[model samples]
Target chain A: MQTLEMGVAEITMRLISVIETDEIFQNVMVRGEVSNFKFSGPHAYFSLKEGEYLLNCVMFNATYRHPSGIKDGTVVKASGAIKVYPKRGTYQLYTESILEGKDYGELYKRFEELKIKLKSEGIFDKPKKEIPRFPKKIAVVSSKTSAAFHDVVKTIKKRYPLAGILLFHTSVQGKEASKEIVNALDAADRSSADVILLVRGGGSIEDLWNFNEEIVVKKVYAMKTPVITGVGHEVDTTLVDYVADRRSPTPTGAAEYATPDLIELKRNIDISFSRITNEMDQKIDESFDLVERSKKRLDFLSPKRQISIEKERTNESFSKMIKIVVEMIKEKRSSLLRNFEAISHSKIVRTTELVPERLDSKMEMMKRTVSNDISKKYLSLEKMEMSLNVHDPLEPVRRGYAMVFKDERLVKSVHELKKSDEIKLKLSDGKILSEVVEIEENGK
Target chain B: MENKKVEEMCFEESYNELEETLNAMEKTDVTLEESIKLFKRGVELYKRCKFLIDSASLSVKEVLENLEKEMEIGEDDMGR
Candidate 1:
């Protein structure tokens, strides 16, 4: 007989191919007692034993539909395909489904019965208490040494250190766990905690069965302090979780739900502060605008403003009066010059004709008389012209003198004016309308 | 609400008072003097709230330690 020698890799490959192609091995259901059950990330690694025979099983993404009672010594029936791991040169069952044994089936039925009974009693439908938005103190009911307790403490400290924590330590799972939980909840309720957190880490159904106890659920329902439950992983919902005021999937989630985050609170405070300050600033600005408008209205009605307006009017009237006076003076002077020239021409003609017709003595006497009358007339005309030059209306105004008027009448004497009389003074360029504040009488 | 000093107020009390002060100041007919008074009070309330938040610390009660001692004594008696 010739013995065929095969390499280790070749033999392993052949074994893998044989298992993968076999119809019975490709799809099989095995029933055994579960042991060494552990989780790695999202996968479950465990061993199923029937007496001395043992089979290794691996469930990928086991969190989706993991059986409730999977633990050491739990009887389960798993359905999966047999596959050889090339790296370890070992075969394992890649499990797809698991069914708990009759014992867990009874437990599940009891859980359902209790749940329905409680629901019918309206305990589950009762209105839950409102959780404080900013809790000052929180009571934590958990195992003294559990990782869930530590996780909750760490998460709360990191998020909101303002909240004080009071631990109500107890045995979270055991024969006496339900009684201890009830006692702890009673103590927490009596404490001055704003909120109570009932928490435990994730475990198998049997491991976490204490939370499903009827006494524990009733105690949670009767708690005066609002209860927040975080008993297991996201897929595990215990009886106590339904009665709690709030339910978080994990211990860290419970802590986060109980206390507000400091960062978010500070952001809200900042928003409120800016809103208040902005409103105040707008009000102050509006007040200032109102004051400014009032000031402007007051200035428009001030006596100083009225005086300036009246002065402008008086200046306009004074300019018009000066123009008319100058025109009248020019016309009188031109007419007087024309009349003098006509009288002188007529006298010269009359005298010359008389000199030719009369005797010498008579002509001489007549010429003397005519010359004397002419001289007299010329002197009177010169006197009148001098008086006109002296009486020029604007002459005094040009020499820095003012013409005072009271009610359109020229003021010629101090007696025409009295104290407290409003009068107008015309100057060369403008006019001043003033009130007499005082009177100085010069006794003549 | 009774008039209390800002120093004597809790965080919620001070915060609520601050909100009230702001509301009063927001009224259109509020006089400048009244607004100024409310603003001062609001500032004090804000300061009190900020102080409370800044000085906060997590304090654990001593009941857990006493409970642990009682449990240890119970286990000792059981062992005996």
Candidate 2:
């Protein structure tokens, strides 16, 4: 209390200065499991928790080695000060030494954490999706510092150049690395990559746990992109493998999925080009065949056929017209003939009446003249009569000249004879019994 | 387009081309002409495959340019 009383401000300042200048700390390298870790602005706080015991730790923004990852549950050698937090009033370490550890306790604790978490989500039990046979784009998720990235890049470039590639730089192992991988996968999923390849070169199981994280595994499972895991060597199996669409032994193998062989692609293209062109050519040929077939069915160019068809039609029409005209002419001729018959009948009647009048007048004149002559020739009449005498119409008949009558008409000639005939004949002046049976061939 | 046989082509290029050709040929909708093209391309691919076989059969010494480079191969690759 007396020391505090003397020059209070200067003494307090000296004490604070001494406290600030003092290097009262111990640096240590511990081998134990990391536990109860926390991170606040510019500082990392964690406890190296061994079985039933704890060692406080701190890693600052600077002097914190292991350029990649550091978190709870990581076994590490840390160098720091065992100091009291003035604000919170707790004993803690301000760490400066930091290195990766290889203790069994640390490794097992992390392994158990990951396994239980992944098992709960069924990531380790789920069936993996199949990788695309032909990928248009490939996304690689791995640490840029790793040789695995180089192997993958080299193999992919050799195999397939046309296929696009997207690299996702990430922490390959250690605590919080799983989250980084998840973030990378999410980014890859957001991109238009055709396939996602989560790969790394061979390493210890602890070194490969980034892929085994439940977060990483869940991301792999949920990714719309097809993911192929190439974690560690052929013997290494991570939770990522169980949930990945496919698994490859190394980063080079992952590239096999990313891109096909350029030689193979060229040959395939050549073959496809040939096949497509051949099919086109065949189609053209088939169409030509069809066209030819149709043309054959229609024989539309024979002139002889046309001529014969025309001839038959013309003949039929000609016959019908001729028949019609002939019928018309017959009707006209009949009408004209009927008129001619009427006129001729009238003319004949008139001629017959005129002829009788003329004959009667001549006969009257002759009668008058003959009466006068008779008076004068009364005495001569006896002489005349005597001279004209004894003329008998039967004289010829009596002299045996035959006379014949047909239907009460005189027949001078016998030329109109047929097989069936009837004739009446008178011979001599007196009627004698005509019983003569002599038959003669007569000529008139 | 030149008549360089697949056997003479770079193994990567020939194999890739062959893969594409096979993919196109496998489609049922492809026409007869397409099929014929595929067959011809397949011939090119077959030649390339033959080349690969020949290459693989060669001894490591025959494959490598220098004797010293042989030592660079991984220890696990001895049998291979």
Return the top candidate by DockQ: 1
Which residue runs of candidate 2 sit more than 4 Å off their true CA positions? A1-120, A124-136, A301-311, A316-444, B1-80
Interface RMSD of each: 16.7, 22.0
Each model's lDDT: 0.82, 0.68
Model 1: lDDT equals: 0.82
Candidate 1 lDDT score at position B31 = 58
Span of 10 residues, lowest total lDDT, candidate 1 chain A: A294-303
Model 2: residue B65 alpha-carbon error in angstroms: 42
Best by TM-score: 1
lDDT of 2: 0.68
Candidate 2 lDDT over residue span A1-444, tens digit each = 554356655655565555545554444345566787666776676788767878776678743453356666676766665665554545566677777766666556776687787778676676666566677788889888889888888888788877778899998877878888889989999998889888888766567767766677778889888888888876567777877787887778878866778889879988986786566556545544433432332122122333455577679889988988998899889888887777657968668868878888888888888987887598588777765664554667778976666555666654544334555667775433233244456551
Docking class of 2: incorrect
On the 0 to 100 scale, the lDDT of residue A335 in model 2 is 83
